[model samples]
Target: MTAAPGPSRIVRYAMAVAWSSFLSAGVLEALVFAVVDPHELRWFGAAPVELSAEALYTLSFLIFWGVVALGASLALALVNLPADEPKPQRGSPGWPR
Candidate 1:
């Protein structure tokens, strides 16, 4: 029997980011909702939101997920950057001391 192939490096990273951000969003949603009611939410501090409580919760969670995903993506990008740049020769213009 042939074994299934594992996910590629980029796929693994994407999965990790998505899962971690999902968890973070859930936690943030719980914390925020614990102290605030969705019904009481205002839009731009002028008009009350028209969404139902369930819709509000869903929307808020998505927003949280997007923000957290963005942060995770940036961190992964930084961590995946090349560790070293190509060095110039000793006699080259960009050579170090």
Candidate 2:
């Protein structure tokens, strides 16, 4: 019997970021909405927003998800950096002669 192929490394990372961002956005939405009414939100704290409460919630959640995902992606990139290469000190033999 043939074994099923697993997800690629990129796919796995993407999924991880997506899931973490999803959960974070949900929690953020709940906490913020609990303390503030969407109708009271304004644009730049001056002009009134035209979006409905539901639209505001949806937009806010999406913004939160995007920001969280960006952070997660950057973290993953840092974590996945190549480990084999060592930086050469100024006077080390590995440094350019």
Candidate 3:
């Protein structure tokens, strides 16, 4: 029989999903920013580098959603863990005895 995923594997899967959400959110925000106006902001403090107000706004939104998704997905992964799965051992018979 195949071995169930180990703790490290589950953690990796959770992290991968979290990072994927971060990247997907960033791309989505960029796409939305393309059609959005860049000057749609009130007077604000100096912006670091050459970023515009709209781009900064998009960045902030991306961070907020990304963190929220990461937390939710990680929690879901932890909560949905399989209960009492049988572990496969090395150099053993079909039953791993």
Top-scoring candidate (lDDT): 1
Candidate 1 has what TM-score? Answer: 0.77
The lDDT, on a scale of 0 to 1, for candidate 2 is 0.88
- Which sections of candidate 1 miss by over 4 Å? 1-4, 81-97
- Model 1: ten consecutive residues of lowest lDDT: 80-89
Q: List the residue pairs that clash in candidate 2.
A: none
Compared with the true structure, all predictions reach lDDT values of 0.90, 0.88, 0.67
What TM-score, over all chains together, does every model reach? 0.77, 0.78, 0.47
- Please, what are the lDDT tens digits per residue for candidate 3 over residues 8-34? 765777677777777777776677668
Candidates in descending lDDT order: 1, 2, 3
TM-score of 3: 0.47
Better of 2 and 3 by lDDT: 2
Q: Which candidate, 2 or 3, has the higher TM-score? A: 2
lDDT of 1 by residue, 1-97 (tens): 6568677668888999999999999999999999998888898899999999999999999999999999999999888554444544556665354
Off by over 4 Å in 2: 81-97
How good is model 2 by TM-score? 0.78
Which candidate leads in TM-score?
A: 2
